[model samples]
Target: MIAESLIQRKPPTKESAVLRDQLLRDLQGAASVSEPVARQLLERLTPHERWALLKYAGKGLRDWLLAAYRDAELSAAPGLEAAHYPELPEFLLDRLQDWEAKNRRRLEARIKNGHARAPETLRRMMVEPIALARFIADRGVDRWETMKMSDRIAFARTRPKFAQHKLKAFITFIEGGNPFQTRRGRPPKKAKKVIKEIRQIAVLTPDELKARLQDARQRLPADQYLIYWLVAKLGLTAKVAYGLTLDKITINAKGRVVIRPAEAWFAMPKSIAPTMEKLARNADAQWPYETPTDAAAIPVFAAVISERRVGPEIFRSETTLLRSSAIHAAMHYGQLDRKTLASISGVSLKTISDMEFLVPADIHSLVSHDLVAKRNRAILGSDDE
Candidate 1:
């Protein structure tokens, strides 16, 4: 049997109770708390009370309180320790470990979800110079230390799965003291070969690309016309076209179709919007079918076909079948040698030059410079500003 303590326990002090209540209120209203107010509150708290507050409060809320205090110190003086919470060291280390474990689990889930390349990306990050790796690793440490948590919770929030893997890798390196060495000097500059290749793809155009869409439309469904329109006319990357909805397309009073592109609508990176608009115009001219009545309706692509209208089992498939088919049709019509067709169709020139397939000239002719430029500036980039 355990013996009772000889010393009697003391009741809570009125000051401590008031402090606790104020701390809770501060945490709850942290978003609106000014730095000066946060610093003043911190100044009033004893070290023990500060530690107790951090230990008891939610991690996110605690981090916000500390951050406000830190910001206050920065605005006043460089070395002011007004925001310093010594108790943070031990608490932060424990929290960092917890974050790392959570991140590892998320990475595993992503790998299971077909993000098989994620591990390779992590490995590449691990191989970077110590300074760069340490910088990223420090972000994870600081994020956890201040309770401003998350694997990618700093400047930009990463996808949960990716964030978990990246955070775990970062924490591991920090704990291990980063075995990778910093590079000795500036790395050699490699020739901008890919940049030139991209420019070539951008400028490439077929002398005449016609009849390719008509022939492909014969074999494909009417709804699939949008895919052809995107690939041939708008200069959209195939991935962007997959996310297109009827809402993004509008028919002006002039009878021409206008496509408003959005970043969320396309799964690709935001930088690709310019290229995508150029591709959209090319697609619009080649597409034979009229726009649908319902603006909210999503376009049906051959890749995502299923028995049910919407189901748990529906999955994305081919992104560029229409473009490939168009290329094949162009080759068959004896217009295969034209470099301009590759630019206009948004297919690589090498694909056309190497492949024996024929695409019609009529399809290529639809990609007018006037239309391409209009779509590029108006739909993809800023036309108004």
Candidate 2:
């Protein structure tokens, strides 16, 4: 009754009517909205208090949108705010707007300079500012440069260190130096060491590995099956596999097939060669189809349905498959010598060591290796877990 009375008190302006139409259109685009429009009594509904006239809806709609935003903030920082402030703080909002503008400018320059994935990388980075802003709002803290070093460290410790990297990158993009870099101090004298009888990584015996591969082949579609097969056989990291070109895999003068011949000259596994060849043949037929020699330039793995329209159709998630294989290989089959593994997989020694290709013990790999481990731990148990 109050909502209706307030809405009815003022005559709906023509601008409000147009804004309402835009709201309906945006709702249609969002995919989550499913409200049916009524022609009989259509009216403009503006939110009361704190919410903007732009993108305005009724009180309920405003609450819903604010609730969703707060939910996202909480996902990043579990206890950032006791309650959503009646209005978003001006400093936070203004800083975010400035950060977004800088992103746009930098994106344009990267595009002009021919950076291959400027759009995608910049788009992903845009989320970091919002996360940082929420951290500030939570503590009622502003002016980061002036914050106590201990307090900053405490806040940084609260957020996932992996996420903080992106935040650091965004800040460095504008500020020209990283504020979040931690300084080394004396180690704690009484730091505890763990003794583990159980292995954290799933290292399968040869029989188990074979059975798992066969099961994956049976369950996954043909395209993905081929990708998984290559990853398991070659021990290639996702970056190397996902970025493979036709020239990377070929028969040498000795009639032995070479995979990643430039770096490793590693022979392709005889068992998987026939399947890889078939996938290559199919891909050769479709892209640069007329020029078979150019098939190497095309992605070996791509989407069946085209979505990007203007760009390559490579399945970015194929990288996930490759990484997963590396992770599993680390547990069971990956090389213990980091240098040898790096040569074979084109994955670095740092990555191999970080992911515990040799040891999945208590000190480091137990807590975090990559974003996946951290999130998995969150789901598996608390931060301590």
Candidate 3:
């Protein structure tokens, strides 16, 4: 059995005294000791004793103990440290590894310069490049330089929106001039509509939509819930919500929240005003807006949510919420005119148009009846005729 005594003993034995002295000496020494060794040392003490040791320890020893305990706790739970980088699989070629290392260094430099704040963001950005490298290697095309624009487009067509985003970031780090044409593979608006319609189905009522959001709020973290709430209430897209910065948001004199997404400023929902104010205050305290180093570049949602990779699953949910909200807005407010709906929801005109088909049959009939009546009146004919 491990000794229950701490560094400070009730009746100090010579061995106990020697151990304490050795620990202190190691802590004060310039050379670093491994956390596993430190954790082994700590396990001998009881929980209360460990707390007591930490309380009396000097700042250096205390910090080391805290780190050791934290590491131990995280190790006990897999994925607790979300930003921990995984080792490349043995199947990956050395050339691919070198390219990944180069990209990683570029990402590290970005972090050092404050261009990117989160390590998980870098991880997400690396996904497509790593996947592409593996794909090419499997096909015996190990070097990325040999890939053509058509090859890149073929790979891109198979990817979803999240991977596409990562692919864009990955291309920027390529050594030579951009190998593939950046704008060549973009699908037209009509093709997008076909895809959108295929994905969307019957619309939910406003109440039903609100209920779903409430359920999500309970299940999701606070930061994620806030983003979804903004999308639901303000009709903002999740991508837009994710990119919000403190500089773009301000609390007005009358205690209303105003957000400037583009050239125009829009008032946010009153229910969320207090939360926005609190977030603004917290952000202001952490990174003063007046700093010359682009403190305003820090995204409010991204900063909070970037500890773990927000992959395709989250984006898929966001898309569902956005489409549902669009339909809800149409049903709740009886909004017509594609442009007006587009302005309100921050979605494209095409999305608004597609959502119109999902509106209740009663609403569609009313619109059809109105149009028919207007046409008859123009011809100077009665409804009976």
Global lDDT of each candidate = 0.41, 0.48, 0.53
Instruction: Give the alpha carbon lDDT tens digit for every residue of 251-287 in model 2.
Output: 6666655566224556666666665666555444332
Worst 10 residues of 2 by lDDT: 74-83
Which segments of model 1 are wrong by more than 4 Å? 1-212, 253-255, 262-385
Model 1: number of backbone collisions:
45
As a TM-score, model 2 comes out at: 0.44
As a TM-score, model 1 comes out at 0.27
Q: TM-score, each model?
A: 0.27, 0.44, 0.46
After superposition, the stretches of candidate 3 with alpha carbons farther than 4 Å from their true spots are 1-129, 135-202, 216-225, 286-295, 302-319, 330-332, 360-385
lDDT of 3 by residue, 1-385 (tens): 0122233233234633554555455433323466465567666554434543443354345445555655554211011011222344444444445555665666556655645244345455556677776665555664666766777777777788666776664565454444334677777775345343244655557877778677867777666667766666656666667777766776556656776554345677666666665666554443323432333333556335552344344433455655566456655676654434454456676666566666654544556766755643543334454
Say which prediction, candidate 2 or candidate 3, comes out ahead on lDDT.
3
lDDT of 3 at 45: 51
Worst 10-residue lDDT window for candidate 1 reads 76-85
Model 2 whole-model lDDT (C-alpha atoms): 0.48
Off by over 4 Å in 2: 1-119, 134-161, 169-202, 254-257, 286-296, 304-339, 351-385
User: Candidate 2's error at 334, in angstroms?
Assistant: 10
Instruction: Tell me how far the alpha carbon of residue 327 in candidate 2 is from the true structure, in angstroms, after superposition.
Output: 8.1
